[model samples]
Target: MRRPRYYTPTEVSLHNTIDDLWVSYLGRVYNLTPLVEEYKGNILLKPIIENAGKDISHWFDPETKDIRTHIDPISRCVKYYTPRGRFVHVPPPCPRSDWVNDFGKPWWRDGRFEVGLLTAKTRWIRIINTLTSQEQMLEVCSEDTLDEILQCYLYYNSHAASYTWKYDGVNLDMSKTLSENGIPDKDEEFYQCLMDRDLYTESICLYFNDDLSEI
Candidate 1:
């Protein structure tokens, strides 16, 4: 027998720049529009939706009582704002350091911080270009892009902070798992989540390095 699918009402509203992909479990809104329309429609969004079925309408839409579960990643991000009136947005501060054991040493976990910063920067660039009547030099987007963009930010930040350390040692290898654990019949949600984390973190390290050249 095949496994059941999950969908969310938020995805339905994701045809454009919709904010707040509400997840009942999280109790917080997430940006999903970018994942739906931007970032080339993140590879994960479609599968989850296709499997969810029409019943997803129950959660948000009154027309259909389909128990929607997942939503577009980009639309999910609008819930977070750029704080005060600053062009730059810092990562949500942590009273305790987000330290992680990687590269055979202790490292500051900076992915969340970088993600928040990049999101602000991306939003700022768009706002500036919009005001100048520019041809939209900055990209218009949804919250879904934050995850991928954050990966790039963290990649660069890590390298700049601890250039001497080895990155591969801390990187999580998700691509390798898909090949090794090929369960075509199943959604591979567990494996994909791991891959997402690995990809996001490693990419952060790389993006951080590349960003240095601009400085």
Candidate 2:
């Protein structure tokens, strides 16, 4: 049996109007807020909104050290940020100081581009969570959870509507040029464009027809 929620549906809506008057942290400015905003319009917001309260606040609030913190790492697995202002996987490589001198690693060779926040934070947070005696603190997600995180990352990143294409052969249609040059099976039907006049003459003559005695 559950006691009545003080903020019922009607009360919640009215309170929402009042809450709107308060600084929203996300008022119209996209960059000013965290990635959590993009999640609000989602269908999942219903359950989350319904449950959000003073209790949930303690979770997200830095000072509370609530149980929500442990779950937050898992809940937020899908989205994270990079230091460059780009949202990527793994937090951006630590600032140069933290990388070579402080952390002592060749972070550059690690392909620092895919760096994101969730996984990186998980590494340190797990240690703290384990050593801490508090049971309410947030726990880190397991390695197996990375795939799901990546899936969510891709879904959110894929929303961009525009794209760019290279202009290599827009005018001349260089399919034949590519096939004849070095592309595999250019002589067959796949890249018939590679079999064009200038291509065949240029590539075929340059290599196969050249004098072998010089070799």
Q: What TM-score, computed on C-alpha atoms, does each candidate reach?
A: 0.16, 0.16
Question: What lDDT score is found at residue 101 in candidate 2?
Answer: 37
Q: Write the per-residue lDDT of candidate 1 for residues 38-98, one digit (tens) a residue.
A: 3333443442234221222223323322222333255553232222211111222223374
Top-lDDT candidate index: 1
Predictions in order: lDDT:
0.26, 0.24
TM-score of 1: 0.16
Worst 10-residue lDDT window, candidate 2: 21-30
